[model samples]
Each structure stands twice: as structure tokens, then as C-alpha cells.
Target: MVAKLRPYRRPAIILAITAIGAAAIFLGRPAIAEAAAVDGETEFVLNTFAFLIWGALVMWMCAGFTMLESGSVRTKNASMICLKNIGIYSIAGLAYFVIGYNLMYVDVVGDFIGSFNLL
Candidate 1:
């Protein structure tokens, strides 16, 4: 039984490692905290709840993106394309977390992209 299960375990381990690495990359970046003071309890609660909702919505979007792209593309290329999209998303997430988010929110230079702060 152990010998039979060994083949299946490698994929699971790889998935676990990928998830850990992605989480580490995301959490290691500097996050932009709300700078403005919360005037009331209502605002605080609303903001927190809004973000929670946004997280769900974004996850839904990822599913939608996968389905839409997979459905639209040729059958032969679907897996390859989906993997590409996943990789692109991971890279974009890391890039945005590290630089893009800060550039957009903090210390705006003008209407365009904000200045780079390598914090």
C-alpha cells in the first residue's frame, strides 16, 4: 500500500510547496495600510467587510477567467494556456504587491503611476 501511494504523494507535495511559496511571496511584501483615521465604528466595520467581500469576488473572478479562457481556446492548447495564465497572475501579483500597489496608492507623483518606493 505504501509503495502504491508513493506515486500520488509527489503531486500533493508539489502542490503544498507551491502554495507555501505563493503565500510567502505575497505576505512578505509591504502592505499599504489605510492612512486616514477611522472616524466611527461604522466606517471601520464597513471597510473591513467590504474587503472581505472583495476577496470573495476576486476569487470568483479567477474561476471565471479560467473557464472563459479554457472555453475560448483550442482544446490542444488549453492546458498550456491555463498554466501560462496562472504563471502570469502569480508574477503580476508579486509585482503589484511589491511595487504596483504602492505606486498607485502612496505618494502620488501625478495622475499617472505613483513614484516607486522600494520599502
Candidate 2:
């Protein structure tokens, strides 16, 4: 016979969550957070770390898409699916580097769009 969990659920869940939250709060502080002053160096480090994390997440997301697309296709076509996924990601990044970079870094030449010069 299965023991009913309902009676213990409230205390058990609260204890588990409290333990996890305490651990996270106490253990998740990095060296940067310990800095005494919020200086340019700290700002720079935080920005760089944030960018690296964002890039890693984007790469992981792309990999997931590739896997999902490949798995959805027939075995014979999976290779094509993988290739297309990678190609699309590559082209999209390149396009962003060209257009989006220009949009952000260069002055907007047109009111609606960004710099058209191919970089």
C-alpha cells in the first residue's frame, strides 16, 4: 500500500524549498559581488560576463534547434536538416554582424533603416 503523501506535503515542500533557497542565496555570490566599490572595472566585468553568458545561451539554443530539426526528419534526411540548421544559424549571425552591427555602431542614414553599406 502506498503511503499517502498529502499529510507531509506542506512541511516537506516548505523545508526543501527553504533549504534550496538558503543554499542558493548563500553560495551563489561571486568574487565580483564582494567588491567594495562599484567602479568602472566592476561595470566592465559585469558587462563582459553578461555578454559571454548571452552568447553561450544563444549557441545552446541553436544547437537545440539543430537537434530537434534533425530528429524530426527521416534518417536519410537528417544530415540535410542538420546542415540546413547550421547554415541558417551561420547566415543569420553573419547578417546580424553586417546589418545589426551597422545599425548599432554606425549612424542611421535613413529614418526607418540603418546603414546599408555591406561590412
Candidate 3:
């Protein structure tokens, strides 16, 4: 019987994982809802905590990507790839500080596009 079901094992494992994930979401709904009902100060603290946690996760992801790229590329070019990644991240941060915030938060009057003026 086990041999007969061997071919189906992959799908069975996937289905099991999906079922466990579904069960977790179903079970955790109440806690999620409760967290949504916080007061102003509690909400501020929660939002700040969430942002810090999210930022840490993003930093970890950057490191993971750097490692993965360095491992996949040729040895001679690995350092260049790491440098490019660092440069890209730095430029992205600079762009966000210079233009991204103004584009997002500043109000616009046109139907499709925002005002060209920077805040």
C-alpha cells in the first residue's frame, strides 16, 4: 500500500501543508481581530513595533539576496555583484528620501497624475 501511494506522496505533503496553514489562519482570526481594536497609544506602539519588525525582516531579506546572488555568480564577479547590490540599495534609500515621500504624500489635483512640484 505504501509503495502504491509513493507517487502521490509529494501532493499529499503539499495538501498537508496547505491544510495546516488554513487551520492556523482559521484559529488565529480572533487574535488578529483583537489586535485591530487597540487604543490610540497602543496602536501607535503596535504600529512602530510592526514597522521595526518589518524593517528587520527586509534587512534580513537583503542579506539573503546578497548571499544567493554571490553564490550563484562567478567567483571573480561575486564582489562586484555585492557592491552593485549595496549601491542599488543605497540609491533606493536616497531616492525614497528625495522623491518618493513627496510623490506619495503630497496632494495632486489632476485626474490621473500628481503635481510636478516637490514638497
Candidate 4:
């Protein structure tokens, strides 16, 4: 019976992973809704949460790109490509937080950009 069941294991594992991912997203919905409800001074919390979620999504995309690149590239270049992608994400995130964010939101002399609040 165990030998007979082995061939179907891959599908079962995929289904299990899919179900777990779905459950996690479903559980997170309520927290997102609650964060959205906050207003005024509490709005910053919501905004921060939104940014964090966006960053997480970007990180996820980076992971996918890393996987695709590693798979498509030659064996000799696979490690280098993966490392380059990782470095790009690291530098981009750091630069965005340290300089780009400030430049975009701070030192603005016109209405087109935001002011330096550092909230």
C-alpha cells in the first residue's frame, strides 16, 4: 500500500502547501481591516503597516526572480546571479530608506513633494 501511494505524494504535498498559504492570507485579512480603521494620529500606524506589507511583497518578487534566474542560467553563473539579486535588494532597500525616502519627502521646496516630518 505504501509503495502504491508513493506516486500520488507530490500532488498531496502541493495541495497541503496551497491550503496552508490560503489559510495564512485569510487570517491576515482581519488584521489589515483593523489597521485600516485607525484614523487621525493613528493613521501613521496604518501607513507604516502598508509600507511594511509593500516591502514584503517586493522581497517576495525578488525571491521569485532569484529562483527563475538560478534555474534559467548556466550552472557556473547560477550562484553569481542569485548573489547579485540579493545584493540589489539589500542596497535598494537601504538606499530607499536612507536617502531616497528623505529626498522624495524631505527638503521639498514646492507642493509637488512632501515636507520633512520623519513620521
Candidate 5:
């Protein structure tokens, strides 16, 4: 019987060690007091930085599209293509900020009605 159990000893010990570690995790878990939690100003700064980084990524995509179009077209038309992209982006940015934003939260359900979230 001991010989038969010999092969299983290593597996059992490994499982025991992992179980011990999992139990110990709660002891070392990080805790923060409500008073020490992040404030509104800190959250605002973080949100602004996140928006800036996202806007930068979008600008890179716009640059890539312009480059692709410029590389494919004739030399004379390259400037026109660049101008067209700039114009479109400018108009879209203006419209989104000035008008599109106000329409987003109008008469919406789901979260507003304490219901399930949707895609």
C-alpha cells in the first residue's frame, strides 16, 4: 500500500501547497479606507488623460489614412487629398461636440430605468 501511494505523494503535496497559498492571499490583500480613496479631482485628471490618449490614437489613424491616400494618388492631387481629410475631420469634430453630444442621453432607457445594460 505504501508503495502504491508513493507516486501520488508529490501530487498531493503540490496541491496542498497551492491550497495554502490561496488561503494566505486574503491575509495580504490590499485595503483602502474610504477617506483615503481617490478624490474627484484625481478622477477628473485621470479621465482627461485617458481622453487625450484616445484622441491621439484617433489622430494617428487619420494620419495613416492620409498617408495611404497620398501615396496612391498623383503628386498634384496629394495636397488636395490631405486638405479633404482635414476638412472632413474638422467638420465632424465640430458637429459631434456642438450637437451630437446633446442627443445621446435623450429619452434613453436601460440604465435610466434601473434595467439591464445593453450593447
Candidate 6:
């Protein structure tokens, strides 16, 4: 029995050593609260960065939708779908460039509406 089990001993010892090392590393690491002490300005910057990333991803979703729709539709209608998607996104971009940015950022003291000035 001993001779039969001798071949597995080396592999078992290696696995045990690896597990102990992993455990030590995990135990020695700092807690999340201690490592994530973001200041107010840093928090603001992070928030702005997150918004930019979210906006970019949202804009790119139009292309993704176009691809998905064109691929799922018939060959005869795929071109039409792609064109429609492109046109819609172009108009949306123009509108946002012209008015959306101003509306979002400019100081308007109204409770429900913003100024019409170009921002």
C-alpha cells in the first residue's frame, strides 16, 4: 500500500505549499477601507472620469446596436437599418453639440428649465 501511494506524495506536498503561500498573501493584504481613502478633489476627478467613460460607452452603443440590428435582419433590409442608425446618431450628436452641453452645464437658476445660450 505504501509503495502504491508513494508516487502521489510529491504532488500533494507541492499543492499544499502553493496553498499556504496563497493564504499568507491574502492574509497580509490591507483592507479595502484602508486602501481606498480618496480625497474630495480626487473623488470629484474620479466622478468626472467615470461620467466621461459612461458617456463614451453610451455613444458607442449606437454603433453596436446598428451592427446587431443589421446582422439580425434580412440582407435586403440591413443597409436600410445601418443607414437609419447612422442618421439617428448623427442628428443626436449635432443636437448634443449644439444645445445639450450648454443645458447640462450652464448655470440656470430655474427650477425646471435652463437658459438657451450656446455653451
Worst lDDT run of 10 residues, candidate 5, spans: 110-119
The candidate with the higher lDDT, 4 or 6, is 6
* Stretches > 4 Å off in candidate 2: 1-12, 15-37, 40-42, 105-118
State the C-alpha lDDT per candidate: 0.81, 0.82, 0.83, 0.82, 0.79, 0.86
Candidate 3 ranges beyond 4 A from true positions: 1-36, 99-119
lDDT of 3 by residue, 1-119 (tens): 99999999999999999999999989967776666566888977887789779978998899899999999989999999999999998998888767876665467777354554764
User: How well does candidate 1 match the true structure in TM-score terms?
Assistant: 0.46
Minimal lDDT window, size 10, model 2: 104-113
Better of 1 and 5 by lDDT: 1
TM-score of each: 0.46, 0.59, 0.59, 0.54, 0.50, 0.55
lDDT of 2 at 27: 81
Candidate 4, residues 4-116: lDDT per residue as tens digits? 99999999999999999999989767676666555665877767788889979988988998999999989999999989998998899787877678766466677456554
lDDT of 5 by residue, 33-108 (tens): 4336788889878877897799899999999999999999999999999999999999988886665544542345
lDDT of 1 by residue, 1-119 (tens): 89989999989999999999999998887764544555677786887689779968986798789889899989998998789888977897799789876775576767376766666
Q: What are the per-residue Cα lDDT tens digits for candidate 6 across 1-68?
A: 99999999999999999999999998799987688788988887888799899989997887899899
Which residue pairs in candidate 5 collide? none
Better of 3 and 6 by TM-score: 3
Candidate 5 is scored at a TM of 0.50
